[model samples]
Target chain A: MALDQSVSRRRLLQLIGGASVAATAVGTLAACGGGGSGSSSSGGTLKVIGVGDQEAGLRKVLDAYKSSHSGFDFNLSFAPADQVQTALRTQLGGGNAPDVHVVYPGNGSAMSMAQLAKAGLLADLSSQSWTQKIPDGFKGAFQSDGKTYIFSPGSSMLGAIYNKKAFATAGVEPPTTWSELLSVCEKLKAKGIVPIALGAQTPWITQLIPYALVPGTVYAKTPDFDDKMLAGQASFAESGWVDAMNKYLELQKKGFFNDNPNGTTYEQATSMVATGKAAMAVQVSAVLSAFRAASQTPDDLSMFPFPATDVAADNWIPAGVVVGIAVSAKSKKSDQAKSFLDYCGQQENLNTWAEAVSCVPLYGDAKVDPALTLFLPALKANKAVPFMDQRWPNAEVQPTHFAVVQELLGGKTTVDAALKKMDEAYRKKA
Target chain B: MPAVLVYAVVVLYPSIAGAGSAFTDWSGIGNAKTFVGIDNFKQLAHDSQALGALRNTLLLTVAIVVVQNGIGLLLALGVHTGIKSRMALRLVFFAPVVVSPVIVSFLWKFVYNPAPDAGLNAALGAVGLGALRQDWLGNPSLALWSVAFTVIWQCAGYSMVIFLAGLEGVPAELHESAMVDGAGTVARFRHITWPLLAPAVTINVMLSTVGGLTLFTQIIAMTNGGPGYATDTLSTVLYKQAFVFGKFGYSTAVALVLAIFVAAVSFLQIGYLRSRETAA
Candidate 1:
């Protein structure tokens, strides 16, 4: 009987301990704006789709809007990033689209602005003042031929987010030149370290490395590379695409990347770098939060530009406007939808958003915290280039990128063949 | 009438809509639809992912139906010979089928865990079988088979039970007379028990073949049809394109192909199996 009582008491203690821990975690997230602050309003309801972790930040603005406007109310729902776009499409297809939403094209993301724009589902917020604040370079992510549709409140830039500790062991500063980067890889390999944690298993992730590296090539060529190519004035085979693939082949040839990259998935690659088994990763800026959690170092990982070439260095940035909020053009209350875009530009909302998602803001006037630092070298050299696969004329080009990467890593196709295949695929799209 | 209307509204209409939209670029919203003739189908035929998924799905179906039946028949023969703990054995065999596919996937995902520190690998290392350790989900060559094995392992017990039921209904006098004629267990199985177990075979093969075709949750929860289209089934590719990419129009076309493929293949298999049964 005593044993039973003691066991029960122990179990009770454990339950209380776990509950307290969970409460604290929830409290911390809530303090950051997870939820519970949206004020009640009486106006026709506005539905917002976002993440639960981001609810705290969203609620600050949502609650204020609801409270101040006695005539309107907003109902917010949270979904993981992968679920948002599909759910939006389904709801829209059924004629029940949400008032506002978040979007992720997902791995090898075939989701494009073209699909949204062509369908006329996305609203034209071309009239919004914030649109002008966007750089001439990044204006196309939200717009196709200079008309705005859906609004992305923020975006995640792709780059080499390196482990500082890994750099220290290799006795190399983060390489800023292509030659230095190769030397660094050789040095790391000599020390029994895998210089690059490449994952071809996801196929999409394999493409991210090349995509991140292509910004410099775009800069070397000019900002109008995509437009020229899309308009039939430029050819991919002529662009620094050949050079980019050559660099990738060089990395493979040097034994710089992990063995059997095709055998590794996105998670495995991330784990490799995070666990300090591998030195660096070429991925999106959005990976900071997840990378921090994975490595248990929410602070150590930092971003930088890939060391392409000197001429390319100045133009090597891939930036896309992401997660913009737009009112539906078909919406009955166009005025309300317009107001939401205005709200997105507000200082508190901007701060809440950038801080919440750990994203770099699109606007120059928007206040940025010094702690949310990214690759200053890369940012200075290259501005945000558009996400590569998104700019493809046909959706067919997107899946091609995923496949060629796998082929490259699998050793089934050489760099030349992959590029040739890409041209063939793109030409078909044309 | 209301129920019928609800079914039509909820299920039948969408299905027809999906099939109809396969030839068009509908994107999934609004009324504007563009008919592009066979562009989407041409894409599907060359869609490396879709084609790979179709091949993988068929591979899984073929492997599962064959292996699942083979194991079920073997179990039936053993269990029929009046064994102790027969009920306990039956319970153990049928246990996995009662668990949900999600749970089954999760359980075997842990078993197939590629990391050295994982449950299966650790056990193998412990048992001096470390040589057999594999990156089950990560290896392109092995992932599909690993996923197929998980599905087969889970459902094979149900197949066993069905066959056991068929075996019970078999006349014991015939088996005894065969034994009196000096016919061995293997020969008896080939001639007598196997011929009688046709109904069970038909049921198991048909069900398992369909189960393999529509496989989603386990693949989704496990390898996600990856290491690069390694284990992709038609369902996963359709899902990734429709849900993840919002290329619902393209995805619906893929779904049409899958529907047609499953229906046609099952129809053919049913005909072949039934003919074999009649011949027996």
Candidate 2:
């Protein structure tokens, strides 16, 4: 009986020791994590998460803010575009989101401003001076229910980032009409250059060509197409999107695109144009820096609006507000985060961020990237539309568009079928 | 009692509560959930994407189970002999089992690069087999098989290790007795080794079955369920629903169904395999 009691006592002591060790370990981890967790204004290091496209501008502003503010500090990290949808959204869902994070400008994406603002996950920036300065046309990108929730530097132009040397080799210039574009492609192809580098394997890349086309094919003809779609008066299948999809297939059928485009990636496509293996890739001006970085002669690369129609007057461009940052509504450092966003809203700071990202400044006559010069006349003439997905009612339509495009590219689906699928996805609940 | 309480709090509670979300229209964030009475499940039944993913999942699982185990058995038999390089071969075969699935997926992705002058195509060209080269992951018909090959490559080693352990446990006395009875190599393997390895086969098959059913990491790292949903499995569909489509409720329903399906399959497989073991 005595031995049993002694053994029991020893076991009790061991349990106590183990519990203590575990408690200490927990304490240590918590203390380590404390540095990154949202904290009060005085000495807190605000955590910031951003997507790769936003890194150049977001990092510049953050570094500037840190240098100027005596007490301000930040821990900044960037996620690739695909991971932002999964990893960062998971963080947001779990309610452990960073104080500041990247949010796409409009409603279509899962990580867009409208969706997050509706979820009550973004802090309101309605009272900020820059919010007041936002143009009426672009307000939808920054606001939800008449309140601004995101701060974007400016709009990114969607067009072809073309290799100047490749064009020179083919003795061609940037095309202004669909026929001219096709003729130019034929010339480039004859010159032994892959006319276009399409990387449909990258999900986001699949949407760019269609986005570049639809601004003219769909929106230019029906200026209120988004409203008509919202009211159920228009659908993808019965609209000009069929023409755009046909043109996309026409390019493929003519062998204008690199071989096995569905197998290639965004990086591969970028390098193809950069190295003169391909003449151009339909891409956003936000990625011009990436194209330039890929090229040995950065000056060899420039942008031109991707022509969608034979009529030059009807070939409008797509210039949507680039991805921006928002203060998390649940952040403990909401004020600090808001202050940083407010700082980002200043005219000079806005220009700095916009210039870094190769986008047009939101409210200023700031000197824009030279590569974007060809797109200015369209922007000036009010012949530009926000990206089609930006006004989509729900997140489902965009991914549907991505899938159907791949299917079209792989000869697995017809243009009619692809548009039908997109229309079905569009009709789903937000 | 404390350990049980801890398990209840840490594992059981979260799982049960998470399962409850399958019945609602919770968008995965915030407190705005509506109890829609299994609407998600009803919708899932009609979801073409989910159905397609189910078909892909079953195909992947079957391929992994049959091919992975077959290759593993062959590898085990080859290396279990009195060869001078047996240990080296064993180490080489099992090396991939220790690496991260994400890393392996990335490596294989490089090998599957679609360029004619790069990766597998280049190697094929070097061997005068250029005509055999094809887009490994981008082609809709080939993508699912490409992913299956990657999973098998990484996991066949794991099966080999398990079979090797079973081989170690097999007694030399049985083999000696069979040989003394004038049994040839094939006869000895059929009557002695194969019967003795039943438990190992059961274990390998069960583990691979579960692994195949829930395969996620490699697919996400490599394909992201692309090229017109050719490579999508149930796991990717649920993930896309919750995070990508903002339909957490539907995602949870998928997770619940997948969990139930896996459990049912495992129980049936274990029962059959256990009976086989007993008979052996």
Candidate 3:
């Protein structure tokens, strides 16, 4: 009887195991089936996904396109910046990306035009008429291996977005030099206003201060710094990056930034500056609308280049091509998506989108946002460089830069160790 | 036979195919992969980030298994009595268990806001314990514990329900006889209740252990393993390797190791706990 009971017990165990496995398998299939439903191209509606920052321009253009051309319908959605790196990338990897989706310019991110185009995941946009009109300096951002893959409105200036009211309260104007910036910050602090609102908790936010600084400290001194780094002739630890990082820390030591920056978020910092609790934040012109919306006095805000050196002439700015859209190679409605992109490239639509986002139109001579007047001279003087990560070989360096900056803000790592970590990340295979 | 076929097609095939990627260098996109036998595993062995994540995972598992289950048992015992409000107490305690982990994490994130005038800090000041205020999720040293505390707060109720079921199964006759005799409540619990509760203890321990070892959603939702990777676990590291760093093969290797480790731990724990149950 004991022998019989043991045999039955073994069989019962097998039965339970098989049932559980079957249930799990069915659940997995249901999940996989559900995920593909959103990307389907049925009934001629083009599926579109964009980052939140692109919504103002992207949605306006899409709406205008729909009104002008009947049957050019689109299903538009926006993902937060961080979610795009994961959710959209997963869709791309799974070969179920939307008909049109956001793609960052240049090569330093997983969802960048170069990376996706190299994977044969993005439709070639080289045949579009506007591809030929891309400025010579901005060609590298739009093209990978001589093929255009993404369409962007224009370059966005990275600088300090300040409240005129806050600056006036402290009796200071936007500083034109590093020493002047320090004096202005001291004045702002004396008036009990935070000089700078650094939101290091948001990973992408941590890189802006460095981006605002590196144009002068690294690129201005060595125009071919990216080329030398690519050739293994230069490193972040040995270059002007050290001075930039030291200046960054020097500002912190002087208590210019808001308290516990690593704990603060981008929205919090934006609110601080908008409410005049803080004087300024190093930010991109693309987000000027967000800052304006957060303030009761939207007209009080304007932007100027964040000074990086004591010499006013050395204060170069970062003006990189803004995040843009690409047609997925796997989309069944590629033609429709391409047409929409082409529509976006028309000078009128380009200017409209650029104006909505407060960026410079890519190829047109249009009136730019008035708040960006201070940085245009630098752009005209060729004192501007593309965002540093745009030239990085791989995605790792950008995230490592973000992490090290947070570490620096948290007092968890020194500049030397932080730069060393970045150097190590830079050496990784792309 | 149909179930077996479905299982093979849905579960076995994809799992085995995915496991094969561990020996290659796939970048999680495209057909560009190279066979690089065990290179990922070798790299993982020396990877400081992965090592640190492992340490975090183990620490979290131990803390959850001990503290979560301990509080659960106490709650179970407290609510098992004939108190007039026992059902209401049980319902209140088990409420969080029914809510989604993502929702719980987000709610707790707001509670841990670092500003002195907001969330937990304000509450601390209200209670005259202002000195206890901290940058809860922002401080590297405190982030992991804060995440752990959230997980515990949300899960202790689950353990309580399981222990409550075990408590219901304990024989009331034995307690009654002991009460009539020279036995007190503590003596009866030590002699009769604790030993009989061994099976419930075993189940709670195993479940909490596995859950803690695989803790991902809370940490990701709260910290994204930030403030310099102080809250990262093996799961988040593997996720970042695949999605963020675009190293799919290395991520798969890490996943396979984590799977094998969890399985081995569950097996050993079940074996030891089952024997203890039988001995009890």
Among the numbered candidates, top DockQ falls to 2
Q: Relative to the unseen true structure, what is the C-alpha lDDT of residue B271 in candidate 3, on a scale of 0 to 100? A: 98
Candidate 3 accuracy as TM-score: 0.93
DockQ for each numbered candidate = 0.26, 0.67, 0.55
Candidate 1's residue-wise lDDT over B1-280, tens digit each? 9999999999999789768888887656556777988788888888766777888988998999999888877776777777898888888888998999998887887677666667678898999998987777666787889888888888889889899999988898998999999999889888998898888888888899888999998888776666656788999998877765546667888888888888997899899889988998
Candidate 1 positional error at A116, Å: 1.5
- For A287-384, candidate 2 gives per-residue lDDT tens digits of 99889889999999999999999999899888888999999988888878877888898888998998889987777546778888787667656677
Tens-digit per-residue lDDT, A1-430, candidate 3:
2332122212322322221221111111111111122222223788999998988899999999888876668899999887898999999999999999999998999889888888889888777777777665666777776777899998788999999999999899999998999999999999999999988888899999889998889877787788888889999999889999999999999999987787788899999999999999999999999999999999999999999998888888888889999999998887778888888999899988988998877775567788887875676565777888888889789888987887787788899989998999999999
Name the best candidate (by TM-score). Answer: 2
Number of clashes found in candidate 3: 0
lDDT of each: 0.67, 0.87, 0.86
Distance from true location, Cα of A165 in model 2, Å: 0.5
Candidate 1 residue-wise lDDT, A156-198, digit = tens? 5666767777877878777767787889888888877789988
RMSD of 3: 15.0
lDDT (0-100) at residue A8 of candidate 1? Answer: 26
In candidate 2 the C-alpha lDDT for residue A174 amounts to 99
